[model samples]
Target: MKKRITASLASVLALSTLVACSQAPAGGGEVKSGGEKKEAPAEKVKLSVWHNFSGDDLRAKAVRAQIEKFQKDHPDIELDAQAIPPDGYRQRVKTVAAANEMPDVFFAHAGTGIKEYFDGGLLQPITPLVNKHPEWKNNFMEGALEALSFNNEVYAVPINASVTSLFFYNKSLFEKHGVAVPKTWDELMAAIKTFKEKGVTPISLGNKAAWLAQSSILSSLADRVTGTDWFLKAAKQDGAKFTDPEFVQALTYFKGLADAGAFQQGFNSLDNTQMEQYFIQGKAAMMIDGAWALTNMAATGTKEQLDQVEVTVLPSVPGGKGDPNSLSGGAGGGLAISKKLSGKKLEAAYELIYTVSGPEGMKAVAESNSVVNYKVDVDPTKVTSLFLKAYNLTKQVKFTPVYDAYLSSQGAEAINNGLQELLLGGKPEDIAKKLQDAQAKSLGK
Candidate 1:
C-alpha cells in the first residue's frame, strides 16, 4: 500500500494474495486452438499444482473438472493437484514457500499481494505468454491484467471478478413477515428486530475464518461510513488512521448489528458453507456474502428455494461518505508458475496454468455462477434469475477497496482478529488503536 491510492492503484490492489515460495509449474507450447491436445513428451514430466477449490459448490466443481480434464488430455504429463481447504490454503502454501518448496504452479493474487514473488523472482511473469496470445489477452475485461501486473509485467491471470460483498435475502420471507428489504440503516435494524421476533436468523454469518466478516460484510459496510477515499488514506497511513473517528464509527455500526442479534447463534464457529446452508434451508432470512455464492446457491438450492433469493447491497448509513451504489470488488488472481520452470518444464507449467485460466476454464467457472474477467458467453438455461441478477449487479456498481487485498500481512491479521474480538464485546476504539499501531509498524512509520 502507498501513501495514497488513486483509482488506478485501487484497481491494482483489487486482486488478492495467495501462494508464495519456491518450485514447480508445467508444459506450455502450442495449445490446439481446438482446446484438445495430447502430450507428446518422450518421458513423463510431472507438475505439482495447489488450489483451494474443495467444495461441492459449482465453482469448485467447475475448477476441479477442468483440472481433471487437463490431466486426462495430456497423458504424458503427471499433474499433481492438491486441494487445500479454503481457510488454511494460504498458510499451507506460504509454509511450503518458506521452506523453499513452492509448487510448480499455485493460485496467487495480483498487485501488492503477489509483489513479493514478482520482486523476489520466486515466480516468472506470464506477460510473454499473454502477448503470444493476443486474442486471449484482449478477451480479458479491461483493467483485469493491470491488477496483477507490476513494472509492465503481468503475473497471474485474473479469473474471477471477485466482488467481495452483497446481501442475499429470502424475498419471500421478508414478504411473509411484512418486512420490506432494508434500504436504510433504520430499516435494516427494523428488519433485524422483526426477524428476531419471528425466531428466524436475520442474517446468516459465518466468521470462523475471520475473513468472512471483513471481506463479505465490513469491506462495503466500512465504505458506507468512512468512504473509499478515507479508507485508502487510512490504509496507507497518509492523513488517517484506523483509530480515526470515521473508522471507529464503522466498527460501532458493525457491532450494532451483532448486538442487535442480526446473525445466527454460534455464527463465529460456523463456516461460510454452513451459513449459506442455513439461509438456503430457510433457517435464516438473509446472508451477506460475495457473488461467489451465486454458484453455491444455484448448485445447492432447489428451484423454488433459489427463486426466493434476492440480492442487494448494504443499506445506506446516516451521513456516510461512500457511494451507496458501490461494492468492494475487482479482478481476482489465477495460477502462477514458479521461477524454477524452464525449457519443456516451463512450457508444461504454462500449459498447466492456461488449462484453468484460458478461455475454456474461464467459461466453465462463469457458467457455475462465478464472474470471470475472461469474456465467455454463459448458458442462460443453466443459470437462475438470481444468478443473472447478481452477475448484472456486478456490472453496474463501482468497486471499493478490500482491505486484505491491499493490507500488509500484519495489518490484515490485526483487523481480522479485531473484528472477531469486537463482536465478542471488545471495544471498537481499542481494536481501531491496535489496527492503527500494527499498520504503522508495518509501514515502518
Candidate 2:
C-alpha cells in the first residue's frame, strides 16, 4: 500500500502556511448561573483523520462504514475524514509533517516507514494506551502490535495484515493453454514462453505508478534468490552488499522476465488499476499483486470470474537459499496519532484507532476477503474462496518483509526506480550498484 507521490512541489510548500494556524482546544465544562453551580455540557471534540481509502471499492466502503459507526457511537466527537489517493498519501503526510500540521490520526504502514515519523517526533507513542487496555492488546495477532513498535514503544495500531507476493492467475486461461501450475523457475518461464506463443501476455504488470513491480515481483524474487536474511543484512549495511552475486542474480532474473515479454506491452505506462483490468479481461494469464486485491476482485467480478482465479506463491528458484514458500508482506497498514494530541483529542484518536483496528473493523475487513491482523470472529463460510486460499497459503509460508517496507524512503525509491530501469534495458549489475549507492547514502556509510 506504499506509493510515491506525484504531487506538485508548490502544494507541498504551501502546507507550511497551514501549520501556523493551530486548532483551538476543546472547552471544559462551564459553571451554571444557579447558586448550586451545575457543570455545563462538554463541548464536541473535532479530529481530522487522513487515510488512503479513496475508491469505491470494498476496502473503502468498509472504512467509510466504520467511520460512520464511530460517529454514531460517539456523537460528541466530530471527525473530519479525508480520503487521499494512495499515490499521494505518503507525500501528503510528509507535507503535513513538514508543516507540523499532522492530523490527529493518520494512516501509516507498520515498519521502517513509520520509524521515520517516530524518529521525527511526529507520532505519539501508543504503548501506554495499549497497556491500559488489555482487551485491545489481547485481540491483536502475535507480532501485529510489535511490528508497529520501535525501540520497545508502539507508535501505531495495525489494521490489516497482508501477503503481497501472491500470483493470482486466470485458471481458465491456464487450462486453455494446457499449462500446468508452475512449481519452479523453469516451469514458470516455460509457461511464459507458451503463453507468448499463443499471443497471450504471461503476466500483467504496470509500473508507471512505480511500486507495483517492486512490492509484488521483485520482493518475491529477492526472497527466492537470497532469502530474507540477506535482504535484512543488506538493508542494515551490516556486511552484505547489493552487488553480491545473489542479489544481482535476483535482479538479473527479473530483467530476464521483462526481456522475454512476460508482461504486457507498454507496461511502464499502465497504472495498477489498468493492470488489474488486463487480467480481469483475460488479456493476461497471471498477475502478481498483494492479497488485499481479493476484496476488489470479489466486489467487481462475477462469481464465475472469481471461481476462475487461483492464488499461489512465486515459484521456487533453483539452488536458492530461500524457502520456496517464503512470502513478501506483513502488517499491511495501521493508524498513528499526532504527538500534539492530548486529553479528549488523544482519547478520541485512541478510540478511532481501536475501532478501525480492533474486532469491529477486522471483522468487516475479513468479511470483505482481506486478511486482518486482529483476532476477529470471522465466519469461514462467509469468506471468499480466493481469500480462504490466500489465508491458508499464508499460514503455510514464512513471511518476509516487503522491500519498500523494510528500506528507508531513499533506499526504497532507489530499488523502485532501479527496477523500472532494469526492465527498460538497464543492466542488472548497474541497477544493483545504483541501489547500493543509494543505500550507502541513506545509511551515511
Candidate 3:
C-alpha cells in the first residue's frame, strides 16, 4: 500500500514556501498541560493536512468528501487537504522538515524512519488525547496499537490494514488450465511450471521501484518459509544471525522461484503500475502483491472480469514449520495528529480522525476493498465477499511486521542491494553476511 504521498510532499514544499513567504504555521501555537486548549476567541482555526493516497479514484473522492464534511460539521475549523505522488514524497517530507515548516497534521507511517519526526520534536504526540478516548482503541485490531507506540506514547492512528502479502491470480486461468490454487511450495512450483508450459506468464512482478517486488514477493516468501518472528529477531541481531538456517532456506527458496521462471520476463524493467497492467490484462496468471492490488485490479476489470480473479496466501514448503496461513505484513495506512495543534483546531482534527476510522469512513474504505485498522463493524453489505474472505484469512495468520522490522540506517539500503544481488546470482550466505554486517554497524550508532 502507498502511504499518503501528498501529505509528505506538502510538508516538503510547504516548509520552504512558508519560509520564503515569512510565515509560521498557525502563528507558532503552543502546547498546554493536557496539550489541548479551548477555542481561542481571537481567531477561526485553519489547518493544513497532507496525505499521499494514490489508489482508486473513488478513494480520493471519498477523502475529499470527508474533508468537506469535517469542515461543515465544525464550522469554526477548516482543513486543507492535499495529495501527492509517491515518487517525491520522502524527498518532500525531508525538505519540508529541514525548513521547519511542516503542516499542522499529515499522514505518516509508525516505524523508525517515521518516528524520527516525533523523536526530533518536529511532530506532536497524541497519547494524552488517545488515552482520554477509549473508543479509539476499540476499532483497532489487537496488537495494532503496538506499531504506533514508542516509549509508551501513541503517535499515529492506523489507516489501512494488510491481510497478507500474497498473490493475486486469475481464477478463470487456473480453472481453464485445470490448475488448483497451490497450497504448498511444491504445489506452487508445479502450478508455475504448468502455467509456463501453458504459455502463460506464471507471475507478473514490477521491480523498477524495488520496494514493490521486495515487499510483496521476496519478503512474503522470507516470512512464510522462514519464521517471521525469527527472521526479524535475526535481522536485528537481538537473538539470532542472518546466517541461520531459516534465513538461508528462505533466501534459497526465493532464488529457486526465480530460477524456475516464476516471474515475468525482464521483471527488473517493470514498475508497479506496468506490472499490474500485465496481470489485469490477462497476460499474467498471477501476481504476488498485497490487498491493495485487489482494489487496483477491480478498478480496471468489469464485474465479470473481477469475478474471474482470486487471491491466496503465499504457499508453504512441505513439512516446513512455517504455515501457509502465516502472513507477512502490517497495517499500511496510518493517520497521526500533530503535537503542535491545541484547543479547537486539535479537537476538529481529532474529530476528523475519529470519523475516518469510524463506521462511515471504514465502510467507504472497505467498500473499495481497502482494509482499515478500525474494528468498526464492517457492513458485510459494503465489503465484497473477497474482502471479507481476506479479512477473515488474516485471523489465521501468525504475523510479523515486514517493512517495519529493519530499524538501522543501512537496513533498507542493505536489504535492497542484497535482493538485487541475490537475483543476480549472489549466494544467499553472502547476502545475509553483508546485510548482517551493515546492520551491525548501523546499530552501533
Model 1 RMSD, rounded to 1 decimal: 18.3
RMSD of each candidate relative to the true structure: 18.3, 15.4, 15.4
Please list the residue runs of candidate 2 whose C-alpha ends up more than 4 Å from where it truly belongs after superposition: 1-38, 133-136, 380-383
Estimate, for each residue in 199-236, the C-alpha lDDT of model 3 and write its tens digit.
Answer: 99998988776666567776667766566677667666
How high is each candidate's TM-score?
0.81, 0.85, 0.82
lDDT of 1 by residue, 1-445 (tens): 3556576676665542212111112354334544445465487898899988888777888899989988998898888899988878888877877777789988887555677566667888888888888999999876777768878888888867788788889999999999998999999999999999998889999899898899888899999899888988888899888999999999999999999989888888998888888898888998889887877777688989988888988789999999989778777878888888888778888787788888888888888878876677788887678888888777677777888887788988999999999988899999999999999999998
For candidate 3, the per-residue lDDT at 206 reads 81
What tens digits encode model 2's per-residue C-alpha lDDT throughout 35-82?
Answer: 234456777999999999888777677887898788899999989999
List where candidate 1 sits over 4 angstroms from the true fold.
Answer: 1-46, 54-56, 72-80, 110-113, 197-199
The CA lDDT of each predicted structure is: 0.84, 0.84, 0.71
Where does the lowest 10-residue lDDT sum fall in candidate 1?
16-25
Residue 247 CA error for candidate 2 (Å)? Answer: 0.3
Best-first order by TM-score: 2, 3, 1
